[model samples]
Target: RGFVVFHAKFAENYRLYSRSHFVKGIELMILLIVYEIFGQPYRSPVAYILITVSMWFMVGTWLFAPFLFNPSGFEWQKIVDDWTDWNKWISNRGGIGVPPEKSWESWWEEEQEHLRYSG
Candidate 1:
């Protein structure tokens, strides 16, 4: 049935959306879920309804609820290709490398240089 195909596609999209780090992905997944579940007739008489429903259940429990309730901001790609263990890897890989204590050193130098030109 046409509805069944749509449901299958929705499930696939939902899976990707839940796992994706980008905001658009999550939004797409939520939209698909609403289309299939919330926007529909009370129940489908089709026999395959159970199958797609199970797919939705699996995707929801494994992905959607977890992402919605306790989302992690960390990108998955960074950890996937990592060669070392968590302890060895630098958690601040994307941030400035300068240490907090020495940050004022660079800030002071830049400020002094700016004052020299203005004065």
Candidate 2:
């Protein structure tokens, strides 16, 4: 039973991750096409703007892709707000974001809690 549950969860996560990467790859391709078209010397202002917006969209999608298919409802506004705050603070401080150790500890705790309740 435990193995079946783990396999199912793993499959779900793998599917989500694959889907996210596939979308990101498509975004990247679009960005590259836009760049190739408008990223040359003596480009018009409008072309530059288009390229910039395309790049931003690609990056935003890459950053937030994982949360798009989250089982817990998509909190787009909250995620954007949090990211904005973190970006502003990081720009001011010129420091790194969440430490890996701390992040790993929290993730471990969450996994253990989930298992405890799930089983």
**Which one wins on TM-score?**
2
How much lDDT does candidate 2 score? 0.51
Off by over 4 Å in 2: 1-15, 19-23, 26-38, 44-46, 51-55, 69-119
Question: What TM-score does structure 2 among the candidates reach?
Answer: 0.29
| Candidate 1: tens digits of C-alpha lDDT, residues 33-105 | 6766765576564633563666556545555443344323133643333223322223323225654223334
lDDT (10s digit) by residue, model 2, range 34-72: 776767768887777675776767666665555554444
Model 1: how far is 87 from its true place, Å?
A: 9.5
Each prediction's TM-score against the native?
0.24, 0.29
- For model 1, what is the alpha-carbon lDDT of residue 57? 60
